[model samples]
Target: MTVALASFSKEKLYPPAFDPGGLVYFGPMFDFVIGAAPDGSLSNETGALEAWEPNDDASEWTFTLRSGMKWHDGEDVTADDLVFTINEFASPDATCGGVCGALAANLASVEAVDEHTVKMTLKAPDVNIPAQFGPIEGSIMLLPQHHVEKVGWDGFESDPLGSGPWKFVSRELGQSISYEANDDYWNEGHQPKFKKLDVVLAPDQNTRVAMLKSGEADLIAISPDQVPVSQSDGFDILTVENTVFSEILFFKSSDPEELTHKLEFRKALALAIDMDEVIEAFYPEEAGKRTSGDAVPFSETTLGHDPDLEPYPYDPEEAKALLKEAGYDGSTIKIWTVTFPDGPEQKDVNEAIAGFWSKVGLKVEIVQSEFATLKEQIDKDGFDPAPGVAVTGFPTSNRPSVLTNMQSLMMSPDAGGSYRTYWDPKTADTLHAELAKIVDDATRDERLREINRELYEQYWSIPIAMKNTLYAAGDRIDGWEPISGISKVLSYETLRPTE
Candidate 1:
């Protein structure tokens, strides 16, 4: 079976935690320590972990490995491998982002008690640890210690090995990756249905659609606009709702003189954009749900979501008033918009937002860049060096824990830091510290709601809309289901030919 994706990484594909695009190829080749269920809840059915439990105060967790699990080289999958994986993720030099940041902050120690048992001690009692370790963006996947020790990190990157149902065959730097069925895969029920899998990168949506029609590709991920085209062509279009949210993240400038440091300026920018019109112009009704005050896209069903919270009303005049009240300096604020694999229309949406800001007496310049360039900038120089505000997709459904979401995005640099930082360090640290210690479900829920309310009022970020992920598949493929609550992670094991 063949699949076409929008983008692929040029770098060597090891330490899978760093690159989302790399995960498309390497994800099926490795198993996670924990897995998330269809509804974004914790599950042990899909990973190497057989069972786990928290101690009396919840500060410590013990995990038991699944019996008889073995790597592709026939090495037994044990607690030592899990220990090595966690330590690598927590390493200070690791390029991993939010997920590793959370682990480093809370994990006091992780040790293999026996061949099948591992014990983890935390700095604080956190119920969200399992969710952070699940198979989601930035989450750690179990790595074979023996292979890495033999090959070294760089060697492992060139030739990786895992215990997943699919084994890595070969990959072209920027074009494609191939895999073959692991006949000895531990999970009997979830064994690979097909012998070979090929994933190719075709950044152009039109080309991807054409490939699908021409029978060159069995499955392709399509954007919201392509829904009609795929539907009309009679292709099976699968959608996963509330997978991610389009958000305008405001970066705190190091210099206090910058306009970005002012909360009034950020609030004015938020109030200026008309999300309803933006949604209508660029997105399908099913894919575009206008977000309210909360930075994270949380529905009523999502934990810690406040349903009573309403969206900020569109009032350009009020935005102008706020700008004037803050002593308008006429400084040009740049809104950086990058091309995302899933949401190609982000540039158009950002143009509309820039127009709205311009009408509110603000000097707004829309700077368009590729996602790779922007990521490189942020990696070299922190968030402060980038544009004041950036339009990007923030995944929420895949991360069910609200505390984990906040810790990953809102915390300061000193406190194991977040990938995106906009809040006051002292306040954010205190709230996160307090929330992390709560063991009771009721108290945790209330505390989470309070934090959301605080962030909502503070204008942490501008939430545009919750986006639904859409995938189009041809008739040649069968028995494949879109992984719920996940945007790009594909279950290659369950995929089989129609015959």
Candidate 2:
């Protein structure tokens, strides 16, 4: 079977490091102790983990490895390997950086208790530790210590080893990758039913769709606009109201008196654009619902989302009034966005926003760049002297926990999370400190409410719409369905031939 992806060809087949940031390398190449189900629920699919428990202080966590587990090379999986991988990820010099740093931030030490038991001591208690380790967005995954130690990073990247359901057969850069079923895989029921698996890197969305139509590929990722068309051709369509969002991020102003710094200015900008129209233009109705606050609509199902709150009305007149009251001349404010595929035309959507903002007596400048370059620029010097708003998207947590939502979506930038609108280092830390002390579920709910309200009240960043991710597959694919959450790895083991 062949699968087509909209993503570009990866330069490296596997990560060269043993860290959480490098977990993407492990996803296709290795197995982890725990993984996320299609709906984003954590599960011990491979039985790598028998059980786990946290100590009384909540600072120490102990995990018991499933006995008799073997690596692809037939080496016994032991507690020592787990300990080594964790410590390596925690190390500051890890090659895979940002996420690696975030994953190991609170780690104090990791020790092997015995041949089957491992202990981790954290500097601070974190309730969402499991999610951090789970295979949600390629965070925590295990590696074979023996193979990596002997072969080293360079050799390991070229020739990776793992006990996953599929073993890598060959990879042709800018072409395709092939794999075969891992017959010796511990979990027999979940093993790949198909004799072979192949993935092609078709970056073009139309090309992917065409390939699917031509029977060149069995499965492919499609944009919302392409969903109905694919369905019309008798292909199966899976739409998940994912925890993904398209939002406008505000950067701090070089001058405190600038329009970007004013709460009224931000509010006016929010009021000026019609999100409903935007949604209709860019996404299918099945793709997602409009969001009221900084969070996506799926977040409303969580603890803190206020049901009574309403999205800002599209009122250009009010926007003009607010801008006038804030003493803003018709000065041009720059906005930026990047090119992306398997989604709406971001450039056109951004231009629409600029047009709406313009109607309210604001001059607009639109700057465009590639996603990678723009991301680098934003990370290094967030609007530095060249202050402007940048357009971007964030994938939300599929977990039903408030901690998961906050940590992944709106936690402060200093906390290694991406809530950079207000750009305060101390805000998130203070809130998290308060949250850590509250043990009552009801009390935590109230606290989360307060936090959610505060974020909305500030209007630092405005969420435009919640995005729905759609997947299309031919009838030959089975056991696959549309899931509305952030599970990066679809359990390929569950996928099989329908015929």
Using lDDT as the measure, which candidate wins? 1
lDDT per residue (tens digit) for residues 1-499 in model 1: 8889887754465663465555676787888788666555667887889888888677999999898888988989888999998898887756566667667767899999999999999988877677767765445788999999999888987788998889989988778889999999877867888899999888889999999999999988898888888989999876766677778776553336556566777788888988789888888875667765554534444567787788877888888888887776787777777766657778778788888988888777777777667656654543554334544443344355666556656667677555544646567767778877777778877877877787778776778777777778899976565456667567777776788
1-499: candidate 2 lDDT, tens digit per residue:
8877765323453442432212222355566666555566666655367677777545788888877767777888889888876776666655342345555687888899899999888887765566556655435557678988999867875677776777878777767767788887777776787878887777788899988888899888787778789878998876555546667776553236456677788788888898788878876776676765534312554666677667778888888888887777766677766655424456777888888888777888887666556556656643452434545443344444556445534455567554344544366566765665454558777778777677777666677766666678887887563223553455555666787
Runs with alpha carbons beyond 4 Å of true place in candidate 2: 8-10, 13-26, 45-47, 93-98, 253-258, 292-298, 301-303, 341-344, 381-385, 392-414, 417-419, 436-443, 481-484
Candidate 2: C-alpha lDDT: 0.65
Each model's TM-score?
0.92, 0.88
Candidate 1 error regions (>4 Å): 253-256, 297-301, 372-398
C-alpha lDDT of residue 63 in model 1: 90
Task: Assess the local accuracy of residue 263 in candidate 2 as a C-alpha lDDT between 0 and 100.
Answer: 75
